[model samples]
Target chain A: MAASSTGLRYPSNKKTIYDRNINRTKTSELSRAAFAYLFVEMITYAQRRVTGIADLEKRLNTQGYPLGLRLLDLLLARTASSATTSPANLRPTRILPLLQFIHTTLWRHLFGRPADALERSAANAAEYMISDNDPLVNGYVSVPKEISQLNCAAFVAGVIEGVCEGAGFATDGVSAHWAEGAGGGEDMWPGKTIFLIRFREEVMEREEILGRAG
Target chain B: MRREWEGEKLPRVVFTLLIVSKAGGLIYNREFHAGLSKQDTNELLIIAGTFHGVHAISQKLCPVPPAQPPPSNIPTMPVRPSGIEVMESANFRLQCFQTVTGTKFLLFTEPQQPNIDGIMRRIYELYCDFAMKNPFYTVEMPIRCEKFDRGLDGFVKATR
Candidate 1:
């Protein structure tokens, strides 16, 4: 009787977040300029208290870290609960898969398009690249004479870096650079940015071990 | 008459928005669309400057007494930093909408513009949508963004 009571009182298994499903149609769409301007203001605001670019970048990273944490859950919920026939798989655990997810899924969600390219660094196993033909953050922003070296998207890079690090993937740091197009510069793509990702040595070793185990 | 106002084939034009701080400082500016007239643009800037002054005066004139203790009672909380300014002319109308936080939205429209309040609402909607939702966007500053411009242009053009 006690055993039956215990079984009935507390089920051994509980529903994980993965067990839930999301309604995909409710996702909100936003205007791009509003985001751009807002981001520009954010960077400018951060510019006030900080001593240098590194501090500003750190602030940006902090700003994005929470977002990354939120996105992880948001994407999972969206994928798991979708009524659509081709339900997307939930959160990716491994490094390659997570990178792929960011490149394709996250990029599409943010920019309405996939990243231009993603590749592992040949020289450094721990390094990766995510390229955007036009960076939304840089659009219409002509940095004045002073502080010209600053890329407002560095904050975004910090966020991406923070997210990767938070997800148990070891990251060294993330840096953003301008990627000039081959053809005459397109009118729409003034803010093209490429984010370079580097992981810690321990992470590379773990990746190798995981590769062998797989 | 209303047909031209609602015409779809107008040239691609964008209006940059700016919200100056109550202290006559440039607080917020966003170019919702591109290719607007220079005269209207200059007028909008002047309007932003003028309104900033007017908003300060209004806030000063309507001062409330201290509520809480000491520094806490320093007329904070419900502090309205500024107000709005709309510049409507024969060719176009520039709407400068401001919030209590001193943040402003400067929207440009055609001279025969109708439903301006709706247009302002849409601009505010865009501000909340893009600026607020974006983790990168800060509280206030000059807006220089291609996406915002493109989106604004698309929205206005569609409405037109």
Candidate 2:
């Protein structure tokens, strides 16, 4: 076999990202216009060769999955660095803390704010929902009437799934649905989105066992 | 009124802007406020190539510490090389900001300009929206979008 020299070269002595601290760096704000533009292109790319709206949402979900996986570690590292508590103490063990992590830490890191609301399904203990008013990714996006049922926020749902899976909480699926003006007519957020998160049966069983142990 | 407005205004701070591709090609170059001497297109191209070479060499020259044993189980991201960040002369300051994807934005500003980082970031944001997001724009290609130019113009004007 011939020797190949086509790989990328990096400077020696560079420390890996893990060795460095995450808290020292300030949160940098990105340009909304740019993000909106990139998202439009992403949707356009995903729109190609897709069977229907569900397929498009699936593509977006897949695109965001890897990001969620990477962000889980990064967000955990940030929390560990910022808080006075030890890293082990900061780890979310049960469903509540895990949901709080996604609602506050993950949401803040991604969109500069916590999710609007977090609620569990009254009928189904395994189901939870995170609500967001005016999701950043959908700021300038206007879904056509032909695909009005489609919610591009499915990408964010995928990220949520990644975080849950990374934390060892197996889930059946995470999906985004439009729930605009559900509370009342005087509601402020007309484009409110509700992300439905359903955990696997085994996960709920494990939670029950852990709950009893605690 | 126009004459009075012109008289009250100060000169522009941003002089020139250049966008270099990941492979170090000069994808976009524009002079907002011309200097005393303007370089021709060929000269600008050469300058871009030379700067790219220098940036790469500088990264190589960075000193590395002795190797240590890897940690057992923690996932770590690879640290990127920090190349030439800023260059200053009596006339102007050259600032370079590289994105995560390795595309570089080089901005030339007045020597005493404040918030160069902010300006560079805004420009980057504009590039992401106007250049990278444009369906007509192919990756690593020259940027020639009307919206990008207009956004940049507005930003530069606001800065002044």
Candidate 3:
């Protein structure tokens, strides 16, 4: 074949990805500086063909969605297999438990800490909010005055949507935005990103039925 | 090492393996046992899409509503519908395993085959390594990873 003639085969000493252990890097940590560098590169790449800030965020979000789906399965598998945890790998079926899973397990896995806050929106029955005091994705990104309304956390919001959808909790939409300041709110945490999750009507209906049944 | 390599080279399972992408496209299909009628690529894609839609509908199917607010302790855990997991007929057995990300693995085996779940899990592990982690592989696209095909073939043979 053309591949062999061109000597495209990888040498054996350099183990192919398929030969590597899935958990080889589980406990290892990556340098934040390296991550920030990559984050900046991704943002610049995402910014290339955007009509507006909203469009750029949407592009970043789509990039993160696949990551969320992959991580949902990967993390669940790791939790089930890891000796440090209980063997039972239970997917949260109800809204409360799902929120708790994201708030604690998912947040910790991704950011090395639990999310700052998880709250239900008072005005909407089907909406919930998860807040991050300082998002690493936003750490390297600084918006210009014209695009100040855009939040790079939209990528993380897409990941959340992917996880929720993968876990069978259909979301109508998930988005990230800056929290409105009560003047002091801005001073306290300038980089705070609030992820808004709006669940679909079907999910809400199922939740109601399950709540009644329980 | 030789045995592991042999696993990939051999085709010995009396089962068929199918992988449906998250977007309801058939990504991979292999029939180790070929007595069943052959399906063209278009037909397979249609089947995958139909299955995906059916699974979504099943997930959305309403649970049984309690007549009134019950007194208490109707087994605290909530009831959730997990879409079709298995189907059996006179000639063949069908088992489906849906990943958290909406990918479906459809395994067709002998009617009386055992340990389908374990085999499914092994295949899922192979997929995670050979397909999911492959940089050349695109999300929700047809998987053309050569190692994936060989790995799945090997794993299935070893299991058999």
Off by over 4 Å in 1: A1-21, A24-27, A83-90, A180-190, B1-160
**Model 3: DockQ against the native?**
0.01
Ranking by DockQ: 1, 2, 3
lDDT of 2 by residue, A110-151 (tens): 998899999999989899999998888765555645677888
User: Fraction of native Cα contacts kept in each candidate?
Assistant: 0.03, 0.09, 0.00
Alpha-carbon deviation at B74 in model 1, angstroms: 40
Give per-residue CA lDDT, model 3, range A29-95, as digits (tens). 7876566656666776787878987898888888789988888887777666665565246777899
Per-prediction TM-score:
0.51, 0.54, 0.52
Q: Answer with 2 or 3, whichever has the higher lDDT.
A: 2
Q: Evaluated with lDDT, which candidate comes out highest?
A: 2
The lDDT of each candidate is 0.65, 0.81, 0.78
lDDT, candidate 1, A24-65, per-residue tens: 433567877667657766776776779986787777767777
Instruction: Choose 1 or 3, whichever is better by DockQ.
Output: 1
TM-score of chain A of 3: 0.86
Ranking by TM-score: 2, 3, 1
Per-candidate DockQ values are 0.11, 0.06, 0.01
Q: In model 3, what is the error at residue A28, expressed in angstroms? A: 2.9
The TM-scores, chain A only, for the candidates as listed are 0.76, 0.87, 0.86
> What's model 1's lDDT at A4?
67
Q: What is the interface RMSD of candidate 2, in Å?
A: 6.7
Expressed as tens digits, the lDDT of each residue in B28-86 for candidate 3 is: 88877675689888888888889889877877776656677666866565666678888
